[model samples]
Target: MDHRFVGTAELVETPSVAVVVDVMRAFTVAAWVFARGAEKIVLAGSLDEALAWKACRPDWMTLKDGPPAPGFDLVNSPGLLRSADLGGRTVVQKTTAGTVGALAVKEASLVLCAAFVVAEATAEALRTCESDSVTFVVTGEHGQAEEDLACAQYIARRSTEPETDAAEFLRRAARSRAATELEQGLRQGSHPDDGALCVELDRFPFAMVASLEGPLMVLRPCPTPSSTGAART
Candidate 1:
């Protein structure tokens, strides 16, 4: 346990760490939640857990879930989060993949959210930080979604080769062959924009990493678009 980087699957060993990636949509939405400005987030592994949390603290949270059908108050759509008033509110999110992995690693010394959007920062943090192990957690369709794998690959590239063209690697990741392979793996299939949107880098900087406690997740300020240059930092 020298370093831990989370990917989509169970785990892997790196030069000084392990990476687990869930690139599809879980971490994607996490970036949004922070960008949109939520005071806090709570990750729930199951629908029942999410509901119970919501029930106990009705005023503190809203629910997010999804898939083939709409089953919760709000789905895992980042677009929806922007306009929602999550001020001083806690969001209890139950995803098909992300939350499950998050639930298992309640003891990650440094559990940061990993997605296409937060890939750069994750790499940077790892390069400078000191940890026994680094884990990359990918929240995808229960081991589906090649987007996360590609993101993992990109992260691997960055951690190993700081001089590599990060942008180009990300670009290649955006349209990876794994995307096609993972899609083909899905029998019923995934969402329409699952592949396209998952790979968009830095769409929002809000990086939501997990805490070493019950259900809580942390938010990190992501670099915003430069052209606009509106909000400072």
Candidate 2:
């Protein structure tokens, strides 16, 4: 399969499959939320869109950028999701990079949100899809973030080599500029544990595949394919 990595979302074009990587936060938070049993997550391009979605469906949770909203059940933080009860609940989310990148590539035959948490599963899912080509999109904050690029490269490696070293990839990501910034933020008392959560690889075993449903980008989990076929009797 042909694979290409784009540094930012703006340059993304139609491909058989597009994987959006935002390991510093965004998609990593999504993975944890799903792991906590979130029924579904809707991706919005902006804070206004996320709030609007909340207005339309008052029962759904809405997460925005910046600090956590007073009445909101969750925010854009993986550390917060670690303690939230998301069972049987749906969430609407808007972030600076991840979701925006996913929404930007509506033309992709398949769209998958990727982070270290689901890296291996995402690779397996892409292999199962058998697409002729795949594109890994690094949805950095404003420009390119080293952490996102690292995660994308890790995913690309795994898509072809099932035995790729996740630990080595994460170790490298932790040394990136984005990770350093996050670590500094933690030291300054901003969600102290979030930095560690962001780099935790393979925390979840499912891939989060997205689909455009009306005005929302809906994400759902898919189990990884088994490595071996059934034996002949």
Candidate 3:
């Protein structure tokens, strides 16, 4: 399979498969939410859309970044997701990068949201997919979001070689601007453990695949083709 890496939501084109990555938080948070048993996540294009969805579906939960929006159930923080009782609940999510990137890929036969947390599982799923080409949509602008770029590269590499070393990619992510901001947030007692949660490679053994359900882009977890062993801390 041919693996292509593109950046931001704007440059995405129709590919057989597209892996939208946002390692700083969005997709990583989604992975954790699913791990906590969220039934599915509906991707909203903006805060207004997410809020509108919430207004109609009072039983559904909403997650977004930054200050808590009115009626939002949680911030886009994996730490918060860990403690939330999302068992079988539906989630409506809006983010600066991840969700937008994912929702932008309208023509791909398969769309998968990824981050370091589910990198190995995503790659394993790609190996079994019957697509001739794969595209890694780096939600961060081209060459701008270092962590997302690193995660995309890592996913591509791991797809071809299961045992590829990830230390260097992890190092790059740790030293990125996003990581610095996350560390600052940690010191401020806001989303303190999220940084740690986002970097736990291969933490989940399933791929987060997006499918358009009516007017919404809903993400659901599909188990990987094979177990990639225990997650790395």
Q: Judge candidate 2 at residue 106 and give its lDDT.
A: 67
User: Which one wins on TM-score?
Assistant: 3
- The digit string of per-residue lDDT tens for model 1 on 57-153 reads 7765545544433334556655445466555556777776776776566555555567876776666656655655555555565454456656766
The lowest-lDDT stretch of 10 consecutive residues in candidate 2 is 224-233
Per residue, candidate 2 scores C-alpha lDDT tens digits across 99-150 of: 8888888667899999887887888898888887888888885546778888
Model 1 scores what on Cα lDDT?
Answer: 0.57
Q: Give the TM-score of candidate 1.
A: 0.71
**Would you estimate the TM-scores of all the predictions?**
0.71, 0.90, 0.92
Off by over 4 Å in 2: 9-12, 141-143, 186-190, 227-233
Put down candidate 3 lDDT per residue, 1-233, tens digits, no spaces. Answer: 78888866446357778999999899988988887878999999988898899889898999888877678888888876687788899999998888888887856799999999888888888888877888888887553688998999898888888889999999998888888888887423248777777788888888899998889899998887576463322
TM-score: which is higher, 1 or 2? 2
- Candidate 1 ranges beyond 4 A from true positions: 1-20, 67-71, 138-144, 167-196, 214-233
Clashes of each: 32, 0, 0
lDDT of 1 at 112: 59
RMSD of 1: 5.2
**Which residue pairs clash within candidate 3?**
none
Residue range with the least summed lDDT across 10 consecutive positions in model 1: 224-233
